[model samples]
Target: MAKITGETRLENVLVYMANMGRELIVADRCTVWLIDEAKQEVYTTVAHGVREIRIPAGTGLVGHAIASGEPIIIEDAYLDPRHNPDNDRKTGYVSKSIITIPFRNNDGTVIGAYQAINKMTETAKFTSKDMELLSLAASYAGKSLESVMLHQEIVDTQREIIATMGEIGEMRSKETGNHVKRVAEYSYVLALALGLSPKEAELLRTVSPMHDIGKVGIPDAVLNKPGKLTDEEYEIIKSHTRIGRQLLKGSRRELLRAASIVAEQHHEKWDGGGYPNGLKGEEIHVYGRITAVADVFDALSAERVYKAAWPLERIERLFREERGKHFDPAVVDAFFAKLPQLLDIRERLTDKG
Candidate 1:
């Protein structure tokens, strides 16, 4: 499946469900809840006029339907035992009439619930026409949400696979740690700071780990040498940049294509002094430039077999010292500008190994 764009897809789905529910039924409040099967809960805020609220199956009007696999229409919420006024009190909404439906798939399995409360007509009681409109909307909501959720699941699966592959590469080189995760997050921050769009930034976050993927191709003797490598071994190590690019090259996927560029150019110095290609300054792609700063910063701050983590001051000094030569000056500035966030990420993702 193709990847979905932006962080707003889920949010947009919820908002649209809520809006449609309100417009079609002319209800004062419409609440859409996506089920959490493991937890046996349906929860949401989406035009519910409250902070996130979660209810268990068989608890309220909506909950009862979710549990019983049926729908309910109550002319007066207070008159019905199945109706729960707790949500009304919590949201400062007075629900007089309500229509709650269980959103089911083709096999009639309940995946979600939709409720429209307080019909706008002075009569207030929900009519047959109202129920018809609502049931149709509920059906559409279930199908629409299913599509969005599937897209989300696919995106999550792809990221996990990428993470596993990155870990394998790091493990092969004996640099076992949370290096990939940290670098991905750091690259995202740098990408955003460099003014890349959110979609591009997220793509960078997912694929940045592959920057060192070529290490898997290196021999153990050279990869895990205890000290400085001999000139030949060092040259061999430098070839990893080209190797990584070639490994990721020819992918039709955008994630792999961006990764290919980063893999090849991350080692290139801004001053035309790096290995493999010696690409200079702006000649290097922004993905490479952003990944370079993140890789170097994390590699320095992180613990290594041959060296311990650098002091924070030393790390700061190096960013300042290498601003234009080893790193792109603007990217370095962005790194320091967002240092607090970076430090927080490092703390949260600290290597347990």
Candidate 2:
């Protein structure tokens, strides 16, 4: 047995299969076609004298092997109804006898097909030995392809989980009306506008939405109050920020950590008059400051059960009036600078439902 090294395994496998076909007096133009089940197509992976080709399953001889999961031997190409002449025409190679064998994975699932065309010295008819060798090669190819597909499935599942969590957050706050999503988008845009790196912008986008996640713990009466609250009620309402922080605390994940900061300090004012520790100017986390501006802007513009939607002009005026008092000066400027783009997003994402 020959020692199989890492770098040349694929090349060696294909060469070995080609030589086996030659020794069996089959075709000189041997090729291997791997089936991508997800795509429902047969793609040539290794070709000796033939140009690699891709064909829909069940369309040609190779397709027959894939569809039937059985080997096929065509001693006369012109006479066999399963033979496809387009391949030879496209590649400008004359066709003769052809042999195709199914490649199955370890679990006996067909992963691809191997095809050999035009024998070098004899008719291109597959012998039992040719079938045996090609089947073995196909098994190796199939297993490799399945592993890649399984890994992609895991990645796709993780993405689905994240999306589901975002949807759950949106469902919880009927008053906010997609507030989580809007804040995420607004924070993302603001971060980019403030000259943060792209990676930081994405992190902020995901983390900022959890800013009001603490509202989940607040009572319906406090969260959905339609009128002005009494001092005591307002104080209870203020506890949400703290609750949000507590809920997200101690996560090692950077996004979750950022969420904890945003949840805790977003309510803190620029002049040191806000609640939940009243951290002064530049004393609060930058994420908290950024989310403060985004949350306020969205809250003002979006209609909630508690308040009517402010007009675009009113929202703009409010931002200007509260610049140094409510929002960080630099963040306020970034907000106004990107106002037009924000309005476009608002228009596109109007809460129709």
- How does model 1 fare in lDDT? 0.84
Task: State the lDDT of candidate 1 residue by residue for 134-210, as single tens digits.
Answer: 78877866766776777778778877877787888899877754888899999999999999999899999998988
lDDT of 2 by residue, 1-353 (tens): 13221223454555554555454454667776777778788787777766667788787888887899888876678888888788678877787777787867668878766687765555346566666766665565556545544654654554354334545555565743467677778888899999999878987886776777676777778666778888988888788888878887996756567778888999999999887998889998778888999889888888777788898888889889988898898899999999888777777766775
Give candidate 2's total backbone clashes. Answer: 0
Question: What's the lDDT of the predicted structure labeled candidate 2?
Answer: 0.74
TM-score of 2: 0.59
Tell how far residue 348 is off in model 1, in angstroms. 4.0
Error of 2 at 312 (Å): 1.5
RMSD of 1: 3.6
Which residue runs of candidate 1 sit more than 4 Å off their true CA positions? 1-8, 45-47, 67-70, 89-92, 105-109
In the order shown, the candidates' Cα RMSDs to the true structure are 3.6, 9.0
